[model samples]
Target: MECKATWRRWLLAALMAVSIVSYARPPASAGSDIADAAQAIHTHAGAHRLILLGELHGTREIPELVRLLATRYAAQGPVLLALEMPHREQASLNAYLSSNGDAHARATLRARALWQRADTDHDGRRSEEMLELIEAMRVLRGQGRDVAMLAYDTAADAPRNDANARDRFMAEVVRAAHGALPRGRLLVLGGNVHAMLERPGYAPPQMPVPMGAYLRDLQPVSVRIGAAAGEFWACRQPRPCGALAVDGSPGHTGPQPMPYTFGVMLERMSVARLIGRADDAENRRAVGP
Candidate 1:
């Protein structure tokens, strides 16, 4: 049964299980890359007048990038920092900032809201790690930019099993929010998973097809930023990583090259595992002593 709840409310509910650090991007540095990313995004915003910079959820550099851009873009107009975190965190989010407490506490309260309010199915239960991203969202919101949750989440029980639901959900938010945002620019922070073209493996094969192809169809302009080629892992774990290391986890890492699709990489991993299992039953065998 498809969830009867509205899309915005559903997004808030289902988003509770999200974790920011799982993708594990490298740390960003204080200079160069951060400035470059900021400058690039800034330039894009200035030129296109609207650009959504897709980011890995919980990447350490993302906050800094957001911090830089939010402040830089502050004068651009109402800079709506659209977060994938839930709406339940709003009150606590504001409180944490108002308390003038430390980063840990602020992060804690934000997570608490996500865990408590992730009952997207209206089942009256929270989700695991929903708080982490919520904490990140809180961090971004505390910055005092004109932020809002895009609320482009589909219900857990949606009729469509694919990410198109998510894409359409986001598109609707952009369209609706765009209506009131004159001279306003939207900066979406979300998992690249939902930002790509939903296909057979990544998305359910049976979902309704949209007119145009790819998630890019939903947005007019997008800018993907990260480390240069063969240098994504510039930072290491256990702190003191990257240019934007507030608490030391390296910034963006991986395939090294920026402007590539990590989401697609994840899908590739899924495919590889699937193929491995199909080719060799022993690979799928249960682990044993």
Candidate 2:
């Protein structure tokens, strides 16, 4: 009995140590508030309701958060996932999901090909695609709930280019799908930048404002918004290693912010300053013309 008590004490200490180490490591931003937000929205939104989960593309924790939240609410109803990916790839993803899918293959499909096909504006690229979608599908399937994909983007270059058309498309898609499923739940996973009140800068100047706001007005059921933003810290490793301030900005030195979901204003402004410096140098070097 003495030996058993000693072993239990040692085991408890080890477990506590492991937890402290885990918290010390970065990307642990899955706060209780975020989970509570998910639960609150889940409780309010009806089976036919729409919920948006926005993320700063490069943040790895966001997708994991999505998976966690989705699993937490899997018992609600059939989740119909609407993505920022192109409509063309939905069939491919559907086919892949229907097959005896491997994790590696699903990852490749979600990461590699989907964005390449989805980017209507060649200038706009996704830094880190929502690789969580595939994983979420796997989780839902495991729980015996149906998961479907809907691509909510058009071939147009900018949001302004297809404002009415896109709105109509969303309405029609929701109407059609909701009619069929007994308890259809709509969930849109997109870059936090795009689903904002105004379009991001890389998009055409004429891009309309209030894309997400307008959608909220249309839905009969309540809507919920949850977001996660990435702050750049001094990462010793190739991938980001730690978190900085709660709401800090990324760097804009020799390393350009990869054109992905949304361009950080601070990074962009810094790059402009560097470019001005370079131009000034060239002017000084130039001889009388």
Candidate 3:
């Protein structure tokens, strides 16, 4: 049976698991080479329903690249900016974006946030990055883009406190988000772990396979990309600046971090023109049906 979109009331609560770090990405199982991750995705031509940008948070480059890709893709068809936000704030998030007033939006967003708490919990001053991401989506909306928000997370009545519980909740959220989209149009920004393909060959297991694995079960062709380079600050781990191993473990050795916008990495990666089709002209609204 196909699961449909559904919403339930949720109370605002808990600390966001916003652990920003440098993510490491191994080569995918198969795909044509492209200049950048965006170009790589464009090469797929929206053939897949879910495209996961597995990112290690705390860098400007990844989000900028995501904005560019999301903007370009929106012209193709309906695109959902399915963020890793707690599902409890769906109403507040919708209201924040829909409001034209800056003051009102800020107040509302601060009230029920997905990342930073409204008060002085953990650097409440820096919700700007997340808000900016929201604005990027809003800008596309103003220009008549088929963009929407999916606060897909563990909407637990009480704060979750276990690895198994968190992983299970995230899988459920990704499945729900995937089911809500049309066949091939979900652009997800998430932890690299969630974007990995399941490998049953391993002895025990991949130790808590992420949401992307669950999503892949539903949409086998989902694309995965990682936004990590060597030399990054780890907010939640002992290795503050180090290389990330293939399985998300941190190490002391790796190549230097690229300073530019995805720098020269696009050479090895797929790089395609921003516009996928001629019909993606600027005047076209292409809102979701």
Candidate 4:
């Protein structure tokens, strides 16, 4: 009886040890990659109050990257995540973020006009991944982190024909949002064009001054998202909008140019799932006979 009891005790201890080892193991390789990437970005972003992450919208990677960066920044101090959404949707965003993130909250958010556009060709801003990023931010806020989101783009009804005027308006909105969170780190995610600190040589003489140019005094670190090759959702004018192949061989390589402080090259770019279609379907279901 004594021998059997001793053996059982040993077996139990071994099982507990194995359990602890398994529990202490690091995340999977994919997670490790994300963590490493986030660390690299954080290291590069050292001491900069504003980080302008210029991305080719409609990619799954950029939104995930933003979420990872936001999580990292929120851990250190306050963080403001600014998106290229219309300024008018700010109220709905606030409500959704403050809510419990239940189905009802999500449905209410999906009902917004931004996600219910009649056009089939979306510009990739209204993506399911973007909505998920917002939900992730809400999760961070729920965890008591000082993370806030801002829709800094011009109102939906505002005239968008003038690129120069639009960029200037966007810059002004960002400035006000940053001012509100004076001490917090600001992360602005928008189109690569708007984040350019200087006009590229290829741009036309009348090309509008980029939004980043207006905020030059802030010394924002503009990081352009590059990719080797893959696909993304974009609307080529006059063409039906859909997943477009990215031919990254020509211009994706080489050293970083002026106006961009750094570059993050995604190994493989994938199209972000457009949420507008899904939202439209849902809306139809809600009102369907």
TM-score of every candidate:
0.50, 0.52, 0.62, 0.81
Cα error, candidate 2, residue 26 (Å): 20
lDDT of 2 by residue, 1-289 (tens): 1133433332222112101101111223455645554555455544435555444433434454555556655566566666565554555555544544454454456454434422122222232314334545644564466565655554334355455556444434433444444564666665454444334467666454434544545453322132333342222334443333324332211112222212112211001101122243453233111
lDDT by residue (146-255, candidate 4, tens digit) is: 77777777766777577688888778767666665657689999988898888888887767999999998988888787677788877775787777776662254223
Misplaced by over 4 Å in model 3 are 1-35, 111-127, 155-162, 199-206, 220-233, 237-289
| Residues 1-289 of candidate 3: C-alpha lDDT, one tens digit per residue | 1123343222111111121222122211222222255564566544766666655543334555667678778888777776766666666666654555255565566545344322212311123445566766666666666677777665535454555566566667665656656443777776655555553344245256555555555653334343223322123334342223322222211222211011113212211111122332331232111
Off by over 4 Å in 1: 1-29, 87-108, 111-151, 155-163, 196-219, 229-289
Alpha-carbon runs more than 4 Å astray in model 4: 1-35, 249-255, 278-289
- Top-scoring candidate (lDDT): 4
Ranking by lDDT: 4, 3, 2, 1
Candidate that would win on TM-score: 4
lDDT for each candidate structure: 0.40, 0.42, 0.47, 0.71
Cα error of candidate 3 at position 201, Å: 7.6
Clashing pairs in 4: none
Q: Give the worst 10-residue stretch by lDDT in candidate 3.
A: 10-19
Q: Clash number for model 3?
A: 8
